[model samples]
Target: MNRTARLYALVEELRAAAPRPLTVARLAARFEVATRTVQRDLQALMAAGLPVRAATGRGGGWSIDPRTTLPPVRFTAQEAAALTVALAATDHGAPYAAAARTAAQKLAAVLPAATAATARDLAHRAAVEHALATGTVLRLHYADAAGRSSERLVEPAGLLTAGGHWYLIAWCRTRRAGRGFRLDRITGADPTPEPAGPHDLAALLRGSAAAGARPPAALAALDELTAPGELDEHRTTGT
Candidate 1:
């Protein structure tokens, strides 16, 4: 689980155990992470506007308001397809995507009979041809696999599902490279914008080699990549 989700889940668990808040030590033990990690999680919870409270002392811990309302829920079939594609792009390590899968299972479990069936059907049939999280510009502090750090201003094009993983294609202003970045390996990213440009979106997406423009044979293989559920089933069925 990602730090954000882990923190939120811990808070929920703590809240359920209500008035019986858990110390950072206990939450860390339960999650098998460090107490320091739990502390950071608490800060994240507060930053996200969750009513998380922490206490210090031999008996004190962390607690959240039981009546706090969470962010809104809005999902379209297109968005769902995009999410599946994003998950496929993860090649298996995007923290939030993993949390999302858990969330999806939980949602499917609690949904009424008809809705559950409809959801499953959507899961099985939805086709996402675009990147999952697009249009959200980001200012990234990137550390290369070798540990070199650089700053990048990116216009996130989309997450591409390729080679059994997800990669983020963005118009990067740092090295002036149209980069395809593995989302999971990224050390950190923050949502922020840079000045808009006169660049053409059509040309940017269509022409970037980061799009992994393919030869005829590779393009043929990609014919199947367009389906949002193909990879999920492959992952689930071990096919």
Candidate 2:
């Protein structure tokens, strides 16, 4: 297993064996690694803010503080499969793609052996296509409020979906400002290899909201399209 996976497994093992320490020798044997390697892993975990305590005396080894640990998360096999498949449906080229895959793997690892297999198979069968334009920099043929078409170069900062419609939050090169574009209004999108510049999405949104300024054409359209109180409900539920 990779070091990341090993670290996760180590934490779980330690949590399960809490109150009674697991000696270095026993942990090393369990993971099939050298005793020194186990020590280093424990050190690394401690450095990363895990409350790992080590004792030198007999009948004492290493243990994590139960009070500092999160409660166990339980998901049925079907729920795990459903969540994994939903994550797979996200845009393939989005920044979170790798993270989503890793998260699914971690979830599977924590599940029962048989259930893990079923969840993986179910996740594999679901797919999403043409979900988002590829790359950080894109050339987009966009329509305005008056139905006037224009081409612009934009650096995609983030993607958000509300009320069943997707919006691309981007830094517009033509306007030299941040804007939100409705995916359906984009007539054409050509991705470039250029890297997108840094953008603070939260700050941008907060600033716009504070100013009570008119939003970009796409966002204005989205506000009109969505049902009343939908955005409020999204915020309340934290979905």
Candidate 3:
């Protein structure tokens, strides 16, 4: 499990065992992680404002404060359906797909039967097409701006939709850099058994934004070729 989900599961486990301490060793065994990792996860939970209490001596463990009570979480059927549909939009082959599916199931299990049925139906109808699954290693047949084509092995970082087009941001092994490819220009993609490495997603988005702020070469050339008076006239006339 990922850290976020593990932290949540830890909290639920502690909540279930409230007033009774669960030892670090027990938590480690339960989660199949190192004892030190459980300690770090507890610390993170504490930092996030969870009322987690720790005891250090023999027979001592962690517990949530019994006096603290949380209100029941409530969601409307429409809201539940929307959330399920959103999860269904994730790439089927992505690393997060299993997690997303598990979460959807958990959500359905918590809701009313009728609402759960509606959510399942809505999720079934939603799909994300022609996109590389996130966190997958892909071999792509890519066509570039000048109509040149090349094959590249890339680790998909994420997907973006802008101006009615979809793009894949990936760490390209061929170029040894992060690159964005239009989905339409990628003629083919096949998943590789090798897992993808982590990416600096924020930096990639920033670079994409910066690149987008500049006009295309043809537009720039047009601007340069136009006389000042003609440009002013065109703007004034709304042409």
What would the per-residue lDDT of candidate 1 be over residues 21-111, giving only the tens digit for each residue? 7777778888989888888878866765567888788788888777774544556545554454333333123457655555555445434
Better of 1 and 2 by lDDT: 2
What would the per-residue lDDT of candidate 2 be over residues 24-73, giving only the tens digit for each residue?
89999999999999999999888766789898888989999888877556
Question: Model 3, residue 47: displacement in angstroms?
Answer: 64
lDDT of 2 at 62: 95
Better of 1 and 2 by TM-score: 2
Ranking by lDDT: 3, 2, 1
lDDT against the true structure, each candidate: 0.51, 0.61, 0.62
Model 2 TM-score, all chains together: 0.35
- Deviating ranges (above 4 Å) for candidate 3: 1-134, 210-239
Could you arrange the candidates by TM-score from highest to lowest?
A: 2, 3, 1
lDDT value, candidate 3, whole model: 0.62
List model 3 lDDT by residue over 1-239, tens digit each: 97756876888888889889999999999999999999999997776556898988887999988467463356686887777767655565678876676566656655667877666544532331222333557777767655677887877665554445555666778777777776656654554557688875435444234233222332222222222211111111111
| Per-prediction TM-score | 0.33, 0.35, 0.34
Query: How well does candidate 2 score on lDDT at residue 53?
Result: 89
lDDT, candidate 2, at 117: 64
